[model samples]
Target chain A: MSEASKSARPDGSNRPAVQLRSAVALLGSFPALAGVDLDVHHNDVALLQGPNGAGKTTLLRLCAGLIGPSSGTAMVLGQDVGSANGRRRVRRSVGLMGHSTALYDDLTVEQNVQFWAAASKAESETVVPALDRTGLAGRLQTVKVSALSAGQRRRTALAVLLCRRPSLWLLDEPHAGLDKDGRELVNGLVLEAKDAGATILIASHDLDWATSVATRRIDVVGGRVVEGTVVEDAVVKGTVVKDADA
Target chain B: MLSDARLIAAKDLRIEASSRVLLTQVLPFGLMVLLLFGFGISPDRQVLGEVPRRSVLEQVSPGLFWITVLFAALLGLGRSFSIEAADGNLDGLRLGGLDPAGIFLGKAAAVIVQLAVLEVIVGVGAILLFGVSLANVGLLAVTIVGATVAIGCAGTLYATLAAGQRVRETLVPLLVLPVLAPVLLGATQATEAALFGPVSDGWPWAGLLGAFALLYIAIGIVAFGSFLEES
Candidate 1:
């Protein structure tokens, strides 16, 4: 295992990593997330499968403490996502890779990764390894993000996420712009993170790949989680076991 | 919090260095405005009942210089947030767990530096073109520092408020200029006293500018997180 996989593991306790009960989030006057109920345990690689405007991104943002729930309760890493101080505390432990890469175009790949790591208060040593892991160590590291291709930008964003090593990883469309090799790199990183005891919630249209890596599958529809759609993945046996409620 | 502020400030400055938008675009724009004003109010032309167009231009040069700086600061402020709006960098900053107050201070600090540079270049242009002489260099420096800090804090605060909006480019001026009216007036007055005469009269205006800067700084520190969350 690489040193990047040596981050602090989840505690042995059974406390859920994410718990939401009728959590509602609004985008302006419209309810982007109507009401969601979910519970994700530590080390679970959960995939949030949803159609366009189905609120998958909103749910991820809520868990990341970027937005507060308008109604109901949301708890991530033992902090309420609705309170300012709680959200701040939750943010310290969550890593979110949204649709946007969140990169500074004028900054070199190395500078962007280092800035994020430093901002997250992660150790400075983690930066070089993250770049290497994301295949951004050589000449790519010196290139400004604006000069890079779409796949390269995605890799740079991934390097940033790796450097932080947050307890919960929220990735939206993680494989959108990647090539075949790049897609495999993402899957491998997801597995490595899961094995290191990090809980992941990914929203991806690439169903086959996401399902292959996810331990549990969730379907979100109409701004809410489809009841009883949660299923346990038997990737080892290449089958899915539906819940009794389904 | 201070450490985070330093980090964010350094990051912003690095972005500016690489892009050079402020230097190549905004600085030149300010100088052009000064030159245009100089041309419009030719020193040879007389007006205001034989007050001598030269004297008239010199008297109003302080106001013209501050106005030019304000306009340039608007462009600087817009550029500052436009980078964050791009690629959703503001969201990334929020999730980085750095103190919101620190981010506000860092951004405001970067704007202050940029605006200060704009003031220096435009100040020299105004002095040479408008034929104005500085009577009190100390008071002028104090006024520039206070006014620049005030504009930076207020501009940054408003910029974040308008960030991520589709109309951010248009909305920032609408939101900030009205709020910064007092700054425009106070800076112009203090600058006038600094360049022409009566240095004692400028101190009160400079004091007001300083007070406004401190007020906005406190507001930004306390309220920045909320604004950031909304954006």
Candidate 2:
């Protein structure tokens, strides 16, 4: 397996992996996310909590450079997302997984991991181990991806994401298909990724699980950043509130 | 661009290799189609064969070849997208930084290469079964390449576009086959001339086929990124 495709600007590793300015993105002529200004330092694990269609996915997509903003610009390491080259670089650095369950069901567990590892430019040495870490060790050779159960498939997908060694991680609803043990496995993976100098930003509805895992929280409601607080020691109910308008 | 293209191509070829019996089924299916063509035309070879290969090729060859290739292709294209849609693999690739174009190229290359192999098999079957004689191997090869390239590009595009829809199975072919009519006509006509001696002097119908291939490739590259945004 080859390495994944990460951005290799000479100054890529000089500063933090991701930085965002006033990013505005509209979906269906309505603002999906607007006035999103923030900065994330290297290896910082920040949680984004919001309801469905609260611009969580849009913001993540903006930060990942998967789509362009409606008006304002989003910069990854100070490069614009609107340009093709900028978007490529941002995509290389950022690893995003959401409700879409991005794994390919037709491939086997190992092939699934290897494909992403090759794309993200990750080291090949980690491929087998990532599979093993996700509790998919011996099943590599014969298991077709479609045959695996939901949690098992998510485990394999996680294994693939871990192999990439991305500088920035953008996760939307990361805990979707994981069991309790699987969630712990995800937490370990996130911690391990962070330890490797990767910044983590997760958008999830499971507040207790998310708050426990994150050091700070940003609340988005109806396409606006209503609360961008760095909750030092805040609990889920006290610090986080769903927008009535949402 | 070449390095990126080569990388994608390699991945695509690797995927086709890893899959079980992809080409095996193709050759057999082509042979069966050849048998069907033989049975259909045997009753009236004089009626079908003597009327100039151009007319026969124009009306039936492209559709027949595409029908054969499309049936073979449909087996794997959905699997390509379905693989990603499963367990969030698309997100993994997105997060892993695979360029959507590179990814599409890789997947499309696999389909194109597979279709080419199948086309060769079908061509051989057609020759044996339909009694079509190829006077120019080069022209025939070029024509096949053009048709298959067009089919592959357009097929990959629709497959990606229909990745998550309710009626993806029926919708893809409905979208692709209509747009593919020109390539089918062009390929069939060019192949006929290459087989049954020259019909249009030295114009060489392969050029039209090649142009059509290039056009579809450009469309695939440009529009592929847009399909990823489909809800």
Q: Provide the TM-score for each candidate, comma-separated.
A: 0.93, 0.76
Candidate 1's interface RMSD, please? 0.6
For residues A1-246, write the lDDT of model 2, one tens digit per residue: 001112233455644345555677887688888767766555567788888889988888887877777676677755688776787677777777766656555567787677667776788898977777778888453487768877786777677677866677888888777777777677667766755667788899877667765756788888877776565543223323222121
lDDT of 2 by residue, B86-189 (tens): 54445455555556677677777877877777777776666555555667777767777777787788778878777767677777777777777777677767
Q: Against the hidden true structure, what lDDT does model 2 obtain?
A: 0.67
Residue by residue across B1-231, what tens digits does model 1's lDDT show? 899889989999999999999889999999999989888876765446643334667878888998899889999999999999999898899888899999999999999998988888888898889888777888888888889999999999999989989999999999899989999999999988887657899999999999999999999999998888776
Show where candidate 2 strays beyond 4 Å: A1-22, A140-142, A229-246, B1-42, B45-95, B99-101, B124-138, B153-179, B199-203, B214-231
Best by DockQ: 1
Q: State which candidate has the highest TM-score.
A: 1
Cα deviation at A84, candidate 2, in Å, is 3.9
